[model samples]
Target: MRYASITERLASLGSEKWAVHVEARRRKGQGEPIIELTIGEPDLPPHQSLLEEATRAMHAGRYRYSNGRGEPPVVEALVRKYARRRPDVTSANVLCFPGTQTALFAVMLGLVEKGDAVLVGDPLYATYEGVIRATGAEQVTVPLRPEHGFHMQADDLERSITPQSRVLLLNTPHNPTGAVLTADEIAAIGEVCRRHDLWIVCDEVYEELVFSGSFASPFDDPELAERTIVCSSISKSHAAPGFRSGWAIGPAEFASRLLAVSETMLFGVQPFIADMTAYALDNPIDTSARMRQSYKSRADQVIAGLADAPGLTPVAPEAGMFIVVDVSATGMDGEAFAWALLDEEQVAVMPGSAFGSGGDDFIRISLTVPDEMIDEACRRVSALAMRSGVRKELRA
Candidate 1:
């Protein structure tokens, strides 16, 4: 029998790996040291206690299959952590998974049907679109305007919702733009969802990284909590990316449905990592304060540097480690500018176009690299401005 063609949704999904490969080849050929500022990966080490616990678990042969939901201790630890933040939510609402991405995928599989519509913010995390497409769902993008500080507008959100809209995917302390939604804005969106009978899938991976204001959840409202699915991981906040431990919190019915899908996806997460992750969660390191301050400094520097460079408008990020800079005045698209910077200056930044239409003239810069590297990248960007005769305007 002839093999069936790839599904349309799968065909539409583009691999970010291709961009990485291209950069690698270019760097090798040029004999240049690439200062990678593309991916949002923390360069910090994991908690020492977590490392010790993982070592013990490895020696004790604790690598066996666990309950598909998660090991009891890890699940309990996650429940306690979540309860501390969201007292209204119960342990029954939490389900552990290998990572937040896995939980998101499971949630989409369980909730969205073929040809269904899902609302997503423009300049959203690129991986989200792939996950939505994998479910054979249509993605309706809601533009987040830079003029409004890149925050989501409830009116715009409501206007985008349709009868086919089943879920709204949101990332606050959002990726690529680092815009955090205020509690009032979240409440407004909740009200819209309440009226429209929509489900919300919120990615709060960077919740602990907020600098200016208290972290707010869509689940902060009882009515919205009933319809919200929170997917969070220890990767960003705790600097434990390798642990691959995350949890999903939502209505028990939805959790059960997602659990069923999760079982078939990966059977269960590794018990050793889960146990170590629980240890880290219960005994959190005092890194949040340090990490937040460092990122705050970087964010300020990036904003100031971009201001000095002509034709670059940088959005000041209140939280998270990314800033989106508009480069439209340079007479080049985001993709072209990104490639030129990577090739000429050996700086690697993601093209804003990779995010979607609203990102055409923008480039996303991650502060995951060292402070010195960021300074150098800014200097190179300034040099480019000077070469292009844009510096004259800034000097004036």
Candidate 2:
């Protein structure tokens, strides 16, 4: 028997959180229920209108291959929705894909050639490096310091750009860190990218999840808008991860190239799914105010809980459904601490080191669970610290 050699590019990338979750599930079998706070999966149900729209589309026999670019109605609806937020983009600039992950992959594949370099934030979405690796592009990470609230420094990003650098991946209200970029930060990044003549790929999946202030996108600037590809999805906003619907909005030229790549990669997104997503976008099930309130409540609970725990101090999350808790005061590496908590208390959380080097002494917890679960998980985690004699190290 012969097997093809696995690509060298994927050799160094491994998701510790996923591996541990899978192993834990395998050991528990089907009987024991694991309280999952590791992955960023929303527990809420998707919009009922989305389900109704899907059912209607199925009844109407609309489950065929869609236009490679996406169904016209769906694209038009996306254009209108985005126009309300970003007036510069039109329907012609949008290309629908199965999900934001796929859209990201398509954009990277279309723009990055072999040996090209791309800049990313440290402790970023773990998959960014993997996607860049798959394209044979080198990933240079710019550190987002905890002291600075995980904000990306424009100077650091600019310094990382070399002649081979072609792309800058920016995730605002960033994953793991939950730090939203300020308007000034966005403008600085825009200026740097413009000066470097680098394309900006802004991942704004958590745009609507912001708690304290307005979400700023690099696309807000006319100069940056032309060079920016905004990739987003309904997974975070509408709790519709299973729907697998997302879009990439950019210049018409870039959209055309991305459409070509998406068509060849996945043929076309399911027409019924596209239609359902369009319907949901048109009539949001939960008002944005209600959703934001719920998330804010959860964020507050998690932050307060962490504050009470010994040797654990979590930065207040500005947006998104995650909080990164610093565990350096406990004098233990994040991976070891995460596994110890899981084994001793049966609470599952992602080790921050899985994200990047900047996350080495922290752990990331998702706020997707209920209030009671969040309380219980925090109690269990705090118990571990008390047992280890680290409870006195917490800062007052």
Candidate 3:
């Protein structure tokens, strides 16, 4: 039997056990207890106001088709929502999507041409490189190392830029590294991007999830404003990932073209969710402080529990719901440690390699799990590492 080839188009494909583990547990058909430190999903429910508003809209029979570009009132609300920092921003700057993931891909589709290259931070969100790859563009990298607090530096970026490079994809409160760019870091990046004439697509999905450090967007600089495209979602901030509502804020023309490309690509996000999403922006959810504090506590505990574990060093994070543990000292690479722990102790976590090249020696721990699960997962990881003589010696 002849079949179409999926190989060429999806060349960069690799297995990520996080989603696999999630489904595997569900298929057990009953009480299989799996400690999931894999996915970034929050255990918290959606905001009370958002839930009530969505329910009312659903009951009112607002299920009819919405404008493919997005409903006007929601777009207007989004304009006002972001106007504080971007005081000049109007509805022209906003384009809504079902999820930031889709908006991200749309930005590439609208901007990237075949054979063009995108510069991405190494050890970025696992899906970023995949998105850039799907656009028939090559994804280049500038390493974000622990010695540099995992922050991406302008010098490294300048060195990596090539003639084919057309875009730089950045994430703050970075997914695997949790390195939030400071205001100064933002400026350095902006200077380079402008000098190189590169399009800047900055993802601020964890904008409000910062703990030790503050966040500053590339769009904060007026000079970089025209070149910057900002992507964010209500999923992380509002603890409503299921809603799949995300948006892009950029120059009006690009926003409109992006809306056209995206709506044509996926018909714009679900209209119901889009409506409730707008209502969310208008009503606002104040879960920032609580989320930050709880994630910080969980991050602290993850490190403390692994204190006596061999070859493990905690990379202190400034923001975001995840912290990467340097498993280099454990004499085990990330994949080896991750799979061994999962097999031996039933604790599931993502191998750093799942993100990009610089992640080979690390593993990411999610703060979305309950406190007891956090304790248990960390304990199991530490116990496995204890079998190493170095861990025993360090304990003594």
Candidate 4:
């Protein structure tokens, strides 16, 4: 029997990149001691109020089928949320989906196809390539150099845009690197998109997790409004990943066009979940503050722990829940270091290569663990780095 070409495209893009994480999990599952800092699951639970709202909606029987676009209340809440940023935002400019991942997939499908190209930053989120590839479009990567704090430079972006380029996929408070783009930086990138006649599809899932600076996006600029589309969710913001509540904000016409694509995929999220999501957006809770503080503190702890460790250097993140540590000085790339650390010290972390070649020399450590766990993981990581350095000296 034959399958769709998508199977081939996605086969090589699957969990193989996560071999270290998977093995660490398997070991921990078997009762082996392992400090896992691989994935970005929030260490906390959803706010009590959000939980209560979901229960209330359930009791009120919100389980009926929803419209192709989204549940009314959720759409309205989204409109109000974006309206604060863009006074012109309305229901027609918003469409809700299960999560940022689904919204991104739909947006990509609607914008690009086999002959088109999607320009994204290298060292991107792990799933970004898979999503772009699933659309049958080519993924063109522009380097996000660490020398510039991993933010994508506009000149690099302009150079990568070819005649076939149709979209620029961006993530702010970016995953893996946790680099946030300033407003001026966004304007520069948005200008490049405008000149190249490209759609700007930004993933702002970490918008609420910025520690030091305010968040900015192309969606906030009127000049780029027509071409800018942002996908975000409450997963990180509200610590409610299981809810699968997210939305895409764009020009009204784009929303109008993407609604059919969304409908075909899932027909809209569960109404009960939509109700819970509406409550979340409208109530305006400050669920991210604690996360911001905790993640920042943990990141600082990791940096401090590795300060004296030879062959290890932790990059300070501007925002988000993970910190990137450059371990190339140890004479091993990220994948090798990650596997060795897990085997020798029982500490699990994601290799930089899992993200992209730009991160090959680094390891991404999630700060979503308890303080003590992260501290312990930091200790083990430092020890590994020291050992690798000593081994290098002996070889010399």
**Per-candidate clashes, comma-separated:** 0, 0, 3, 0
Question: Which prediction has the highest TM-score against the true structure?
Answer: 4
* lDDT of model 2 at position 286: 76
What TM-score does model 1 achieve against the real structure?
0.94
TM-score of each: 0.94, 0.94, 0.93, 0.99
Residue-level lDDT of model 1, residues 118-189, one tens digit each, is 999998887888888888888999989888887999999999998899999999978878889999999998
Candidate 4 TM-score over all chains jointly: 0.99
Q: Kindly provide the TM-score of model 3 when superposed on the true structure, using C-alpha atoms.
A: 0.93
After the best TM-score superposition of candidate 3, give how far the Cα of residue 252 lies from its true spot, in angstroms: 0.9
Per-residue CA lDDT of model 2 for 338-365, tens digit only, reads 8888888877788888888888898888
Q: What is the lDDT of residue 352 in candidate 4?
A: 98
Would you give me the overall lDDT of model 3? 0.82
Candidate that would win on lDDT? 4
Model 4, span 1-396: residue lDDT tens: 999999999997889878888998899999999999999999899999988888888889988788878899999999889999999998889888999989998999999999999999999899999999998999999999999999999999999888899999999989999999999999999988988899999999999899996999999999999999999999999999989999999998998998889899988788888988999888868789999999999999999888998999899999999999999999989999999999999999999999999999999999999999987898899899889988999998
Off by over 4 Å in 3: 1-7, 11-32, 389-396
Candidate 2: list runs displaced more than 4 Å.
1-6, 12-17, 27-30, 390-396
lDDT values, one for every candidate: 0.82, 0.82, 0.82, 0.92
Model 3 — which ten-residue stretch has the worst lDDT?
15-24
How far does residue 247 in candidate 3 sit from its true spot (Å)?
Answer: 0.6
Candidate 4 or 2, higher TM-score: 4
Q: Residue 204 lDDT in model 2?
A: 91
